[model samples]
Target: MLDADLKEQLKAYLERVTRPIEITASVDDSAASNELRGLLADLTALSDKITVTERRDDDQRKPSFALTTPGQDISLRFAGIPLGHEFTSLVLALLQVGGHPSKLAADVIEQIRNLDGDFKFETYFSLSCHNCPDVVQALNLMAVLNPRIQHVAIDGALFQSEVDERQVGSVPMIFLNGQMFGAGRMSAEEILAKVDTGASAREAEKLKAKAAFDVLIVGGGPAGAAAAIYAARKGIRTGIAAERFGGQVLDTMGIENFISVKETEGPKMAAALEQHVRQYDVDLMNLQRAEKLVAAGDDGLVEVQLAGGASLKSKTVILSTGARWRQMGVPGENEYRNKGVAYCPHCDGPLFKGKRVAVIGGGNSGVEAAIDLAGIVTHVTLIEFDSKLRADAVLQRKLYSLPNVRVILSALSTEVTGDGQKVNGLTYKDRGTDEQHHVELEGIFVQIGLLPNTEWLKDSGVALSPRGEIIVDDRGQTSLPGVFAAGDVTTVPYKQIVIAMGEGSKAALSAFDHLIRHSAPAESAKAA
Candidate 1:
């Protein structure tokens, strides 16, 4: 099923296998099963250590296969053809099961091995989803590391009955032991923290014991990564505490405007940013959300209080907390989230294939989402609050060209109507006529805009604009002394990745200049 070039690459990757591996598949007379057989045949032809066997009477899902080492009790299964974004997941599973060393940190590997009890994880994913691979690869690695853990990555598109029965309207929807675990992109560390209840407390204690940093960045998006690298290059203690590295960038699908790079996806760019930051002597902490920022007191240090009662002290702080998707904030929106309401068209569009959906916005994101969905869904209704489309003229032309798309101008989304279990329609009102209307649909994609992640800074004595963005001078200096801000969270205009990175570098340099000119009494005495 793989092309010639892909086969050559697969062969090169399989050369890393140090042990024998077996593939046991359960198939029926179906097109997907035949395709799975072809894939397995190609895989077996690549490496001498690989073999495949088929058993029709197995109790597992049809068109599924299990990869296992001969002498090991570990096994990772795929209940559907794992192509598209999941192709990397398939390669990683093959090499990992065949004794290839994993790249996870030693501590994280040990933690995975130490987890108690059996974990049966099943993740539903669509092939087009950019965020599904992370979740699939993480769980697959965990299953490979721990013998008690078993994971099955299921293709939601291929298994319509299972998707309908579980009411899975979004990609990367995970379930552990038959109960819903979570939805969306999740890292291995996040998964471990959830299953292991004491993991958070242990992590908090570790954070509390860390020494004060010279420059500490709050956020791990493009801006935070740039700040950490710049500070570390100056031979100072630099650290980054992020809720989730990559921030809103992780949710993005296509990025073509990032100068130099012709085209790339959000997850790939995020990985590159993280990899570049790791080359420096920066303390990288993930999944840590800053709850409060305390201004400098008697010790000339700023304190950042974490959500789990852990506080980090730093001489200078750069806030690049970034932004998140703006919610519609209408009735039933929250109650039906993931059930039928979604913000990411790239991630959740495939789940609503052949169904009717609504795009709530008229800007570039919304217009683009409508254009993309028109090809997959039966029909798309584009709702906009403005009288005219805010997208580029080219995009508007393309959107208008689609026969399956209908645009509604000067309309306001009032409420998201659902059938208690899932969304069935949407309610809106025409602005000019003040006439209420309801459109029957299966899903709603919200692409309004972004809101700065500065709610925590509201009572923290930091000067903020009316829109809740942190107010900063040209030097990236915030109203609070020794504290600065950057990226989408700051007052800087044009929230682009390149701009954020530049702003982050400027903020780091500004912080360093402050340190050199206004050295603390102890440091000045030491220099003497």
Candidate 2:
């Protein structure tokens, strides 16, 4: 199943194995089972430390395989062809099961090992979902670390009956101990915080004891990483507190316009950004959400209160908290979220395979989503509020050429109609005829662009545009002195990644200049 170059790469990665590992597959006589068997044979051929076996006695999911050491109690399984976005998860499972050490922090490993109760985690994922691997890999690592923890990464496409029974209309839907746990992208730290309960309190205590920073950034997207690197390069006490590092960039699928670099995936770019920032002395804080930004106090330090009940003080603050996918406020949209309404077509499109769906918008993202969904879904209805699509000429051409797609312009999405458990259709109003219509579909992908993440700063004296974006000067300075903003959260014209990085660097420099002017001696300033 693997190509020549892929085989060479797998061989090189498998050479790190120091222990014998066995792959036990419980597969039926189906085409998917044959594919899985072929993949296993290819893996076995790549390394001497790996071996494959068949098992029919175990009451496990068919077309699935388990990775375990000879005498270890590890229980990690993949209930589908772990290719595409999940190929990394498969490789990591192989390596880690063969005695390759994990890169997780010492404390996190200990926390996983010390968990008292049993955790049977089943994660439903799609091959196209860029966010599913993180959750799968995390749970696999937990399973490898603790015998009490077991994880099975199931491909929702392959297990249609189970997905329908569970009402899973979204990718990366997770169930724990036979109950719905959560959904969407989740990191190891976030998962730990949810299960460990006391982890947040401990983290809050640690953050409270931290000293005031010279330059503190409040996001971890392109802008925040650039600001952190620039500030740390100045030999200042730099720190970054982000709700989740990578911001909206993590949700992006493809980036062909990042200059110099031809193309890259979102997760790959986010990892590179984080790695670049870590090369500096900047203190990186992930999963730290900022709740409020306090103006300069008597101590000449600005404070940012976190949702975790801890507050951080800084000499200068940079707000780069980026943006999130704008939601359609129509009725039933919220109620049907993940049930039939999804924001990312790449992640959730496979879940609606052979089913009718609608793409709500006529912009670049919306058109692209419709074009992509045309291949996988039975029919795609593209609804636009404007008279014409706002996408580029080439994209619009490609979208119109799709046989399975239909376009409706000057149509406003009125309401999302769904059964209590899943979506059945969508309601829309035709502006030209002043008439309403409904389209039967299994899913709705909303691509109405982004909303700035500045709602938390609304009452903090920070000036915001009518659209809620942070208003900044040419130097990236917000209305609040000693405070700055950058990226999509600011009034910047373009929300591109490169522009955000430049704005972040400029904001850092402006913060540094402000410090120099304010901290200088008054006598020297008067003489000058």
Candidate 3:
């Protein structure tokens, strides 16, 4: 069942319906049926305009939901419970069926509108997988927009038999017309590109740079998108370069604490973010990661070296290359990633709920993860490398406040032990006594630290923190003038979406201010 706050939020979002959306669920003997029934019932109760008609299908191995208008059949279906991270898809599906269009770029809409042939897209996802929702939303919205396209998002866990038949080994494994389309997360542009059967996957025209620009943003995460949007409002030549736009957000699950939006999955929000960025005049360079940055001297253009061997230039720059989760580098750590070892508790924690789990950190994040996992999982073993917990006193109190959590201080994670299919447990060492010990847990949430993605600027002379985060001042200015930085890659402390977005806006404004103060002379020199 949805929580009171989340339920209220969903109700509010669903209030936009001018007509009822019919949901007919075929419940079978699957293990997820009761929970799925409760979830659907709760959703139906939220709005008078939403209704659920349940039928017991003896042959049905899994539950199915087909949302339609009155007396109209929509082939769009969900093959299992849409709880956990998939909750976003369910909500988005309802909205789509109820006539609330999820925004996409005008150009993208036009392309989908012109699509020919009957298309079938099946995207396999886990409810706890954060990256699944975006692809689901994209495919679902495509189906909603184009009647010729039928999208079915099947929960990979519930339908293991079908999953095995399809060889779906990962989350967001998509099949276009029953052919293995893509695995993991995807962007709207990429999804649309794939949907265009007439075009090759590489047929998406490469985004080229303008001769020059006033501001160029590197990295298309939340920060880069925000910066691009803000910079474009100034009517300046603004461009953004990113190998992949969503960054960490693509892998994230459900985001509940994103300020106003009570509940949103990573992929859906990332698509919306990209869509909003596309609304502006910002030049977008997709699939282009910045390989290096060349700082411009006074009145010179700063250059951004991309991974694809292309370089772009601008008068002012905003570095928003985001950070990645710090790895422990133990044996099987990489091997068992997504198999049982996960970096994001928010994204993958629910999958391990009611199972035993371990949190590997003594810091605020680690302690927070321990507390959170303790509530979800049956037992939580908190491991720390220090003699004492390094988290703040308040967080330590909250962590200690939990009864299901046990603390092991001065411990170093040794190896992630697994059965080859999934994580079964891990080994740890007593840092003080050097005694090796093994613990049994189904999941491991790594919360050690975040390593900033500023390595590309290493030779560019951007002053970085000892840990490699870009150092920026209050105004979001980097060590070099005409260059600014924001988001997790910067030394701005907290690494939240709202914080990154706000920092990006600040960086863009500061870049504009810097241009106003420094541009006249550069223009005059060009004239002379």
TM values, all candidates: 0.98, 0.98, 0.76
Q: Locate the minimum summed-lDDT window of 10 residues in model 3.
A: 200-209
Stretches of candidate 1 off by over 4 Å are 520-528
Model 3 lDDT per residue over 1-528, tens place: 889999999999999876689887888666677778888889888998988888895454468787888754456789888877778788888987898866776877778767888888898877767777878988888887778888898876677667546545457778888898887677666776555754433333243335888999999999999999999999999998886898878766568999989998777788799889989887887767778888895548998876545678889999999998899999999887766787766545656657899899999789988887777789999999889998999999898878999999989899999887778898999888899999998888899988888777888989998889999999999998799999999999889999999999999999999998887887899999
Which pairs, if any, clash in model 1? none
Candidate 2 vs candidate 3: which has greater TM-score? Answer: 2
Report how far off residue 140 is in candidate 2 (Å).
Answer: 0.6
Q: Write the per-residue lDDT of candidate 1 for residues 1-528, one digit (tens) a residue.
A: 899999999999999999998999999999999999999999999999999999998799999999999779886899999989989999999999999999988998999999999999999998899999999999999998999999999998888778878999898999999999999999999999899988999999999999999999999999999999999999999999999999888988899999999999999999999999999999999999999999999998999999978999999999999999999999999999999999888888888989999999999999999999999999999999999999999999999999999999999999999888999999999999999999999999999988999999988899999999999999999999999999999889998999999999999999999888788766879999
Better of 1 and 3 by TM-score: 1
Which run of 10 residues does model 2 get worst, by summed lDDT?
A: 516-525
Distance from true position, residue 519, model 2, in Å? Answer: 0.9
